[model samples]
Target chain A: MAELTTLREAIAGLVHDGDTVALEGFTHLIPTAAGHEIVRQGRRDLTLVRMTPDLVYDQLLGMGVARKLVFSWGGNPGVGSLHRFRDAVERGWPAPLEIEEHSHAGMANRYVAGASNLPFAVLRGYVGTDLASVTPTIRPITCPFTGEELMAVPALRPDVTVVHAQQADRAGNVALWGITGIQKEAVLAARRAIVTVEEVVDAFAPRPFQVVLPGIAIDAVAVVPRGAHPSYAHGYYDRDNAFYTAWDPISRDRDAYRAWMQRHVLDVDDFAGHLASLAAVA
Target chain B: MTAWDTDEVMTIVAARELRDGAVCFVGIGLPSEAANLARATHAPRCVLVYESGTIGAKPEVLPLSIGDGVLADHADAVVSVPEIFNYWLQAGRIDVGFLGAAQIDRHANINTTVVGSYAEPKVRLPGAGGAPEIAASAGEVVVVLRHTTRALVDRLDFVTSVGHGTGAGARDALGYPGRGPVAVITDLGVLRPDPATRELTLVAVHPGATADQARAATGWPLRVADDLAVTSSPTGEELAVLRDLRARTAASRGGPTRPVRPTGR
Candidate 1:
């Protein structure tokens, strides 16, 4: 059963140095607060896994918390490049970050394989692309029955998977709707999991197309309202598009990025404090 | 028709490529705009599948990202990411995989990965998201990118997705199920794969864009169709709808009326 806890306690108990951590959210319901808490706890050398390593991953990478990144795409969504990610990959500023890349299909399948407790996942991907040539994890496998060749990718089983959701019941069952990307797979695939929710309710209202993670699968549930800020929580609020565009300039320069992080992340007591700081600035 | 920009014509031309009821796996940015335009105008039944697991998404305004809340709110079904990739895309349910790239070669191969060496320095672009499989398994693929010598390159820094791999028999040799890129829509014009060589050839130039200009913009000695056609200008209705969409998207995102050029991938 999941123990209801605070975000700081959840991060301290669940995440560790050199752990393989996945903060799974596509665009909506991203665990920004959890990621911030992990940074605050000063974890180091984590092998961070995500499909699209957006602003949160960029922050973690900028802070030198990750030694490697296992992901598909790394960009600022509709805006531009994740400048801090580029700095780490290109110039090795702060640290030389290693990357193990794959296509979205490949990454998604890996998570599925992990969730299923399989060795590897097969797909019709990277056949004629250079991804297979560079990433040793992607290999060609011949079908035993059909005599057709396909690609095989090893399963991704993270040590800890963290996700943000709309709500959690008193029983600790987490439920989220609206673009629930790969959270379920990531949670099931990990050894332990933490879910940060907007609120802990008595019962779920049962929204359409909602995914509910049973308390049995989760290690802890943290209540942090507006936890997915910058990213949205479907009905709670809209995505902070202005902040995304604003990130480009701040992340472009190293000094600026560090100063911004020091003020918004390191100096803040918690996610609520971080939110207050942003509001104070705005 | 009223005055229109190059970007408008390119988007309109790309939108025209979609069949009325085709299932399009839409990439964000330009491809998303084009697919949405088709739905808003001609192809009302055109299904838009975003990789974010929102199948048949029908958003009122353009999504800033692939996994925007509006997409999920308006989607026919919201499956898991794994199901979207395996059961839908890899299963060959997608009819058209519309994509945009930073660099494309003569054979339509894409490079959204890097601008230089893989091991070392230069620009590190966003790695392949779903383009590899989309380029491989979709029934057919349509690519859109701004035409410049830098973008229409002879050699890619990295091959992120395979189009017509080396030449004619490439996909056949590799046992790929889907037909490779059928059309590459750009600001200058449209380039369709030559049936004989499987090389992208200039089939049509957009209005006000000359064949020489297209050739100059390409890095290689670009091939031209024997009877190269000059594409018709964007119709008034198309321009109006496109502008309206852009305006609404801008208002929602707190952005300028015209969006900045999208980054690689």
Candidate 2:
């Protein structure tokens, strides 16, 4: 039902140029390795999607991979602004970024609609707000049940959706716990879904509130340990706070960002190589 | 006893706004710190909900972000982002919405989207995540910000979250259910919306903070309440708990955690 492949193979074969890709992770279980792989392969003209679009998106944006960003919010987490994202939006240093903003509710409903094979999602959002002026997709619609008007946003069926989880069984059914986010909805909504996991086990032990993506739903599974490095994988490891703090400085300047990407992400053969480099440094 | 900074004072004032058993929709940074402090002290039963879908999270350490694994681990339940905003926030289950504003106008309209024009901004800020809905539907809103002349502006560059809009009936006419920004907590003083005008008026000044200083910091004509009371200094118990929380957070993160200070420039 699902093919077991390497991260590089998954990125190259499944992810293509000009495709709408969603790297869906709230703050936890961020698919940073897969994002790095996309950058390494040098995919361009891609519309990257996420709720927050944290450091991974920042990295991709800095590397000039994203042509557009469809997101609710983009930042450097507990720190401050995403400088590279700011540069692209403010000055168009690497490239000009076209933004389609939405509220978290609107974006989530978009994915839900996609997953449910619906044309659009309805919600009480963007009412009396300036967001409607900038985003054309957010439009008011009259309800059938009642005469009241509500907001509607089209379904977000991305070309590819990538996420990181704690474990996957050999059968390709992935299990992830703790702030699973909209990974399930994003994966089911995508034409292709790539899941990177910390480990592949014989069978999942079944934790409380675990989301198990059936093998048939997944296109590919890549066993990339510590896949969500700066972000955490719940039971596997704690979030690397030091790295998140360090990213602010590394990603602030154009030169520093490029050099860091060159050394860490682009220069590495794969995620393992990236890990080795970090280990070597430590 | 550890000496409290202005930020701590600001947090203490913000924490006092939360009522026991109230459902608070907490934004990250100062709001999170203040909400957590309230839960740890007076508002023990306060239900904390984060945008990351963690509901009733009780983190021993300050969360690095809303989606910090610790939040999920400590949460009573974790729902989807859509459910959080729609089912909880927009449905008006959240009694209090804690926010941090970059720029707040005289009418309490907040600007967290940009510093200049929408098309061409001098500084592009982190756009609204769930703040719009939270501000619209939460029973009340508490704004925690580092008070400065630049932050307290006459007009907002962009309205990321609508507080009172302009006057009393402004938010109601817009069809929002909740009472918009009830209080604005700053390092110098606390500003509450006038029932009639909906304008945020300086109602109380913190200890060692002068009313003139608070008035001087506001961009518009700051109205001092006729019956303005001095905000009581933070109790030693409150300070100790807050200090311990910060220490634990710093130890966990391998560095000291500090609240964000927004600069309009």
Candidate 3:
């Protein structure tokens, strides 16, 4: 239960370049601030996954920090386009980039099934139509015992999973309090897990069930209060819908996006300056 | 049935269930054609929601995948992936989840990941995307696959998504309740859950299907509904409309995928 001297030191130790990482926050979930820091550090060849909501995926794509993306549906309405991924796919832009499309619950189930190590778990889903060809990860194979056909879903395991939590203790057990999309699975499936907390509580042992992610699965924890700025926490700051509408227009045009990023994200060494710059734009 | 056979009956079946104003989450291939047929005939207002984020898609033909251009070519509105899931799907506004299957067990669980063992897979199909979410959140899910032994499995290689969640009782235990499956419309017939077990039970027999044939094709002990009904053979009226729709669709750039079901039976 040792507290790190600095946030950058904690993050640098947990991450290595070209690693496959899964971020905890959605497009609107500012839990991404930690990951944005990683990107700013010049990580490359990252295969990022969007479990469900993926407004931020475009940002990753636009910045080129994200080379390979695994997701069902990842896009923004007004500004960003599926054109990048599509173009990459046409030319295999990010080599070995795989697109697996399915419903939200379906994506979660596959991950859960992988985490549980269950050979197969049955659910009455996709009964009447053709959502079967989203990805080639799972295929129908004849059951040797019964000779019946079964849909074989693949297992997903990321190299590292970085999640932002509401609170945590020095021990690294953090609280996510629902609205956690595949966070548990990310922790369960990844080789290493990092939990970033808004605040570190000293009296964490007072409550038990409040702990969402256990310390056993966590390798490191970073405490950054109100770190989920720009991206809001659930019911905290409302989603920066302004960001959503603005991201595409800025990123869609390469020159404009690069200029905006240089002005907003890059060239600022400190978080305070970054925050102030973002505020100026808003 | 071969393309000649499936062409007649498949079109007839697709036209009936789909109607105007229905919001259908379309699968890529055959379903794209079926829904398009419905749109051409009587369901002009049926909105097609592709998993790639295009909603209210009226593709000219079937799409190869969700990323197919036609899905977005004739769209009403397009939103972000997160919004589509957080707002529309997980929020449960979609009426139908049109899907295909590689393997379907007794409970209708699907596998879209691998064909062999995970440690070293023999075949890696596409991984599960949002299929589980669709099954869990759609008003109801519709499975469209060719009736055969390979697809109608006793067990799946990998359970892609839980359609009913370990049969009937488990759904309630799981807490997040969904409408689950309404029907699994296949080239052979239609399937529904058993009254007592909620396991997939043969509810309708197609014109060419027999109890013995269905049993022979199943990987499990095929159970027929107590009041199983025979699907009507394609009549001239139905065939004409179906053929016309298929011609227009196939001729159009956006028709469905190859109307071919591999004979794994």
- Best TM-score among the predictions, by candidate number: 1
lDDT (C-alpha) at residue A253 in model 1: 93
Interface RMSD of each: 1.1, 1.2, 12.0
TM-score result, candidate 1: 0.99
Alpha carbon lDDT of each predicted model: 0.92, 0.88, 0.61
Regions more than 4 Å wrong, model 2? B1-3, B261-265
Off by over 4 Å in 1: B257-265
DockQ pick, better of 1 and 2? 1
Best by DockQ: 1
Clashes of each: 1, 0, 60
Candidate 2 pairs with clashing backbones:
none
**Tens digits of lDDT, candidate 2, B79-132:** 877778778888879998999888999888877788888888899888888787
Residues A1-282 of candidate 3 have per-residue lDDT tens digits of 334334566567766778877775533334555655775687777887656334445445556676667665444322223433433444443343545555454455556665677654333334332445445554555667976544555566778877777777666677753234456776777777777677777754442113267787778787766566545454334334455455655654657766776786677764556677888876
All models, DockQ values? 0.82, 0.71, 0.07
Candidate 2's clash total is: 0
Badly placed stretches (over 4 Å) of model 3 are A1-282, B1-4, B235-238, B248-265
CA shift at A258, candidate 3, in angstroms? 34
